[model samples]
Target: MLRARLTLVLGIVLLAAGVAGFATAGRGLRTTSVHVGTVPVELVRPDGAAAGGAARPVVVVVHGYAGSGRLMRPFADTLARRGYLVALPDLAGHGANPQRLTEAALDRDLAAVVRYVRGLPDADPARLALVGHSMGAAAVVRAGAADRSIAATVAISIGDDAAAATRPGPRHLLAMYGAFEPSGIASTTEATGAERVVRVPLVEHIGVLFADRTHHETARWLDRALGHHPQRPVIAAKGRLVPGGLSLVGGLLILIGALLSGRTGAAPAPPDRDRPGLRVGAVLVAPIPGELAGVALAHALPNTVTGYLTGYFAGCGAALVAAALLLRRPDHPARPDHPARPDRPDRTARLARPSAAALARAGLLAAAAFAAVVLPVHAGLTDVAPHGPDWWVVALLALAVAALLAGAHALLGTPWSYAAVVALCLPMPVASLIGVAPGFLALISPLVLVLVGLHVAVCAAAGRPWWRTVLAGALTVAWPVAVVLPVLG
Candidate 1:
């Protein structure tokens, strides 16, 4: 019983970790933006001048992937304050525009913005400059290469591979990138025709564009490229990594996997006495009971299935503990050598032999049903819609079920029952492959199935009774679904 409880707990923990991982991945994807087209183009002028300018140098700011022109507002405002006319334009495939960002489309859109800026009465068509961040930087580089009218250029957190070898005209070119930006590594390696290169220390790819200091530094670089001598180099102190974002989540997963494996050893051995002889009836009925129960439960209490599953897992845990205690009793037989010591006589001889084996097989089938429900629920919680209850709960319940199943097996001392349970648990991965909503849920389904299977096998080996085994199997299958349904919904 104690073994079974422990297995259930471990299983739950694994499930929790998987969910957490899914959440982290989803959050990471959400933080980035995807926008396209000309939503709003703001033109700012120095000296607090109103719009409608021409013949003055203009700086055009373009935002990155999934980002909007709004992100470039601060940069535009700063340049405007510095006596330069700033034009912030939304690129293709982002911001107000529903289209995907394509090279041909972006070039056309950028050309239109340039025309708009040039038409401004206060702006100088001869002194046009272009700036971009990330994907935006790539677009700007491509634009600069094609349009020689651009007098100067600034690429922030620019991708190295995307950098253009052909410099636009003899005009000044300034390249600024953060040291920690993975994309910047490519920038440094790529041969940009720029006469000068400015590398900023300690700034990450994203940070170099977003951080205030980095922005100021970028501004200074622009000034230098424009023939203005700023007092200091435009660079800020290296920034630190954000602690509680995607990085933290990844670290947590590594830590949890390591801790769980170390604490929970391999599955316990099955007692030899409980080994069942070949029986056609037991084999045939192995999968039917659990499938029927799972289907019935899902249909009858569609809304409350998750809760029912949780309760079932809890009961399994209790059974495992009880089985462990019973097995440890002084009266329980230790081996076949002590057959005369009737206190723990082999019950297999009295009971119809195949019946016990049938029950163990049924338990395995139940675990399979539980896994099918739990996996989808787990995926739904983390991937389909993220909410809290955390992956820890799922892992705990799975481990508990595993422990109960193992304990029962130890008590039963039968091989056929244990084998049946293992087989039933094995199908989880196959079921998961068919489909899981919210996509990312599929990532951890395999792990959950494998762990649950191991738990059932251990319990069957421990010679646990048919009733206890069946209950544990049912809970193992059900608990995760119950816990995740509310959050997923």
Candidate 2:
């Protein structure tokens, strides 16, 4: 009854919080689905005017690689409150769009958004602007350079193709880079005579979008250039709440699961497995190299966040596998005449190889674990896998990794959950020491925390102290957040 009440209370609180946020952030904004030739785009328009009003200025806000434009509501609302129309379109392979992840495809889709927004009957084409971050910035440069009629372009935390973004044009440019943007690349610093370059302090790549300076500067530049003096900028706190709201909703669901189960969890066996080399190596030595390799490979991989994540997980996976292979001590068979009793726990017995059932369960549990954690992060915070097929890949990857853990008995604890947690817990310190950028880490941090809570709650409710359910859940989600997302961003 106590557990039931706690679960009910938490669930109600989270649900209330989410609804309040949805109401707050969604005040004047109306979301509509439009297509630029079968490529669906999500447009967030101000509720004020119809087709007959005085032509309003339009700003197309583009998201970074693998990002959903819907999540850019904070930036969109900033511009919308100032009497400008904002169109946020999901580039190919992101958001609700069904295309595969590719830069060339994104550029084409971005161009389509510009054309569509320009054609709006109540929009002033002369005041049309493009605001893009990271990959989106690159997209704007490409589109803006091709058309000189654009009034302004704001490029934030740009990529390598910035040179293409620099063709001398009549269009005004304001380029800003975060202080710790992992990709050292930036928009042209040598003023194009028409461009304004300013580096934002105390931020990294993802932070640029939400930074106060970014909001202020972007609005100020657009208002002046577009010839509109709107009201004093009222930075809405709800911008931060939208994603948090989604996470809260996910939490509510977990609480529901717990209440239904109505039992406490069984804890896993303590770490009794031998071979410190395997355990220590997986925990201590493997993460640094895996993370470093992931970051390095992110740049070299195809210019997609998905590709970078693949490289990141690949590195971490390889490191863990290598550690197991090197540290495992093979067991010798006993003589046939003196065969050991099957039921006895022999001190000299070989490390138990995981059965097919164990691997499958681990895979399924791990997938659920990752999905539980990532559901909110992707839906609210980051753009890891917002669409259908892309989300499936995340599940598949989690399953594969969990199965691998089952196979690596030398590294995994006898109960496995204890081993998984130990190995997983060691990465954060290394991540901090290497300076993975707080902006990037903050995106998934809440989701991770929520997963931890859910894991504990579910374990406690089910009357099982076994860590498999909890650890499997953690690994599924944490693999991408801790191992993949940070490296890519």
Which numbered prediction scores highest in TM-score against the true structure? 2
Whole-model lDDT per candidate: 0.49, 0.59
In the range 398-479, model 2's lDDT, one tens digit per residue, is: 5434433333333554445334433553454345345652233333344344554555444333332232453464354444
| Cα-lDDT of candidate 2 | 0.59
Worst 10 residues of 1 by lDDT: 236-245
> How well does each candidate superpose onto the true structure, as a TM-score?
0.40, 0.71
Count clashes in each candidate, considering only residues at least 3 apart in sequence or on different chains: 90, 18
Q: Name the TM-score of candidate 1.
A: 0.40
- Stretches of model 2 off by over 4 angstroms after superposition: 1-8, 50-52, 101-103, 186-194, 237-246, 249-268, 282-372, 382-392, 404-467, 470-489
